[model samples]
Target: MAPNFSPDAVWAQCCEKLRAELPEQQYNTWIRPLPPADVQRDGDTTVLNVRVPNRFILDWIRTQYSTRLEAILASVSDGPVRLDISMAARPAMARPAAPSMMPPNAQGPHSLGTMGTALPPNALAARASGNYQGGINPLPPSAGPHTVVLSEQGEHPHNVVGLHGGQRRNGHPQVMGLNPGLTFDNLVPGRANQMARTAALHVAGAPGHMYNPLFIYGGVGLGKTHLMNAVGNALLADKPDARILYLHAEQFISDVVKNYQRKTFDELKAKYHSLDLLLIDDVQFFAGKDRTQEEFFNAFEALLAKKAHIIMTSDTYPKGLANIDERLTSRFDAGLTVAIEPPELEMRVAILIKKADQEGIAMPEDVAFFVAKNVRANVRELEGALRKVLAFARFSHKEITITLAREALKDLLSIQNRQISVENIQKTVADFYKIKVADMYSKKRPASIARPRQIAMYLAKELTQKSLPEIGELFGGRDHTTVLHAVRKIGGERAKDTELNQQLHVLEQTLKG
Candidate 1:
């Protein structure tokens, strides 16, 4: 008989894979809260009935997250799994309630909590309509001591907050100077970006959000950078000159190091202190660097005191981040964290079309799908593949077709399979848990050694796409039973344990890494 896969089992695994492949925003909104309804086979293909609260949720999942859904489902079962999203009545099966109003994509203690004093002028202006219905925790209206009373006149339209005490459009705004376009309207909502998009929208209008410090993280090509930029651009429009300075965290560290080297700490402090909005990208780079962490801590403290809005981007969540100091971790935890994962196949196609539209390239749907399939996980790389396919078609005097996409992406397509090797998976799992390679295949039963080994087995099965028997042979002649235990054991643990869920996610990094 075919393997009987439970929806809960699939969902648990989905969370693990989605968190790894997607952002926290995507995870919570698209996958975390949502539960799988049923898994049934359709001829040679598998049909997955995934339920969402409403039509908007279904639509968003179909658009942004479908590719990832397919990839993940493909892994759990042998047959092709296609996602069918629907708005059904609440199921009889008990599921943890989904947070209707979660924290925005990149909110922090200031944005969500009682702390964070330097409120951006735009944020203040947004407070005019009291339209902040989003975020894990909405900022209570009781803040005071400002000479200018918060009111309608302070609210400026077109993403600009023309309040008495707020920053400029070019300036960052802690207030509601959100660019209207940056609202859910301008965002191309799809399965891939839906969760992140929803979380961001909530936070853009809401505050005191639990998804605070919205640590939107993902591979290089995913839209983590895009979503965060949209937040800044949108909010900046609301509060022009609200003191927004967004740069790579590496830049932040370099500046700190430079200041330390040149004795310009005071100047750097002054620059950061003046900001109403601060955005730092690739925060993981600050890991393992004590001085940078110390400086970041100070800057974060100063910003919190000022109530300036802060946003950040990274490849890993605050917890997964290794080598970072504890103080830094605590501060990071003080805010909401959102993650942006790779766009799914449909989203990739949408991205391709969006790019094509931007470039006036007429790409057929078939051609788009072909390109999307090969482009795989990295949103940027996927778009690049589309661009190349278009360019090659134009340059080679050929129409955009499935064949055309294949020939064009012959190089990029090959790149994905290169890293998904057995040895690579073993090493990746080992490196992720900091275990030795010998330990991976050794007979030792230490949970430390065995758990990571199972993770390796799971990864080898998933990433390399090798048969269970093949995977079993790869790990010291361990039979398929061992591989089965790894898959099932990790799946079971992931279902109940959030930490293990996160670790499994970290392991999926092998596919992309």
Candidate 2:
């Protein structure tokens, strides 16, 4: 006789295991919010249907937790287990109730008098004409100064002087230019962004606490902006009334110019100095602008003084920035500084599959790998390549496959192959480290030369299809074991050494370009 199988019980056990295995924040953010799985039996297979709120969560779970979940399910069950993840259907909106026909003295379901509330004549007219805002109550002129209170369940109520000012349609304050679509739920975590992501999470959970004035620097299209937006969105979700703003450094410059022309510097101070959080991007643009830097420094000092958190991003680190005032740069570096490196191979593969899944097309793992291998620059390039392949498949009416992907991305692949070679890698690495290209093929073993040589070997192995022996032959006739040892050593060190990883990322980007 077989034992009874309860899907909810099994899933609860799995959750207990996951909560123990994962960090509290990660489990709560990703796994804890998930509803119980719906299990069904098909032949000899036990299928567990896992529903997520959005494709971002779906992709994240599929990449990070699906294997572990399946294993846990199998161990707890009596037979084979399969996990299927999909987005849950959105709930239907509730219809509004009809107006009551009761007498003025009678208390009905929609009667505000029963709750000791009375609307102004204009407010009643506005509501009847569908012109009233959800959360704002229009008061008569004689009513004088009125305060509106907004509160979520079990949270302190927020008082607003003018509820009609800058409120969103849903009654919440405008999230200060934050894109609601960008949140921690959608931003995929990987080794490339592990440090930066961790810092962002810390700041998000407790803004104005740790990592205050957090600085995130990275190359373009490397998800720096996405991470910043994610932090802002997370904070906004927790505190609906919190004042937050996200803007480009150029926007600050524009504001400076505008206010300078009008001689309204006080207005500028009033705007930026009152924020609970500020998310700024591309501060490199402030390099040559004296007035912008001065104004930004003022705002930065004010924000820090008031214990408001500030997050900024740029193409390079603070010290690497040129033509910027030392005072401002010092303030920028005063707090925690972190770098977001280019995604590694595994991360690139995960990003490709997740994005492809988001398009409602099931991309085979092999095809995704093929695309990921070829498009190695950044997320933007990977997305562009995926778009081309998807468009090609649709245009040709063919299923997506490795061959089809190759044909679709033939031009990109051709350019990449032509530009990136062992010789190119050797030259790029040599140039970046201020070494000689000839040293790549030399027998010299100086630390300075040997380190770059090992890096070249790693890049050659990673970028090309050359066998270990062939790479050794190209590297001054070294043995295959020596090449393998160099590759392993550098690869391992890259994981542990942040500086070395960043250098490798720069070299890879240069070579790919």
C-alpha lDDT of residue 431 in model 2: 91
Query: For residues 289-328, could you state the per-residue lDDT of candidate 2 as single tens digits?
Result: 9989989989987887676889999888787799999998
Question: Pairing residues by index, what is the TM-score of model 1?
Answer: 0.53
Model 2 TM-score is 0.64
* Predicted model with the maximum TM-score: 2
Q: Local error of candidate 1 at 353, Å?
A: 1.8
Model 1 C-alpha lDDT per residue in residues 291-360, reported as the tens digit of each score = 8888788887676654555667777666677999877766674454545545545667777777787688
Lowest summed lDDT across 10 adjacent residues in model 1 is found at: 147-156
- Model 2 lDDT at residue 110: 22
Each prediction's whole-model lDDT (CA): 0.60, 0.71
- Structure candidate 2, residue pairs in collision: none
The TM-scores, one per candidate, come to: 0.53, 0.64
307 Cα displacement, candidate 2 (Å): 2.1
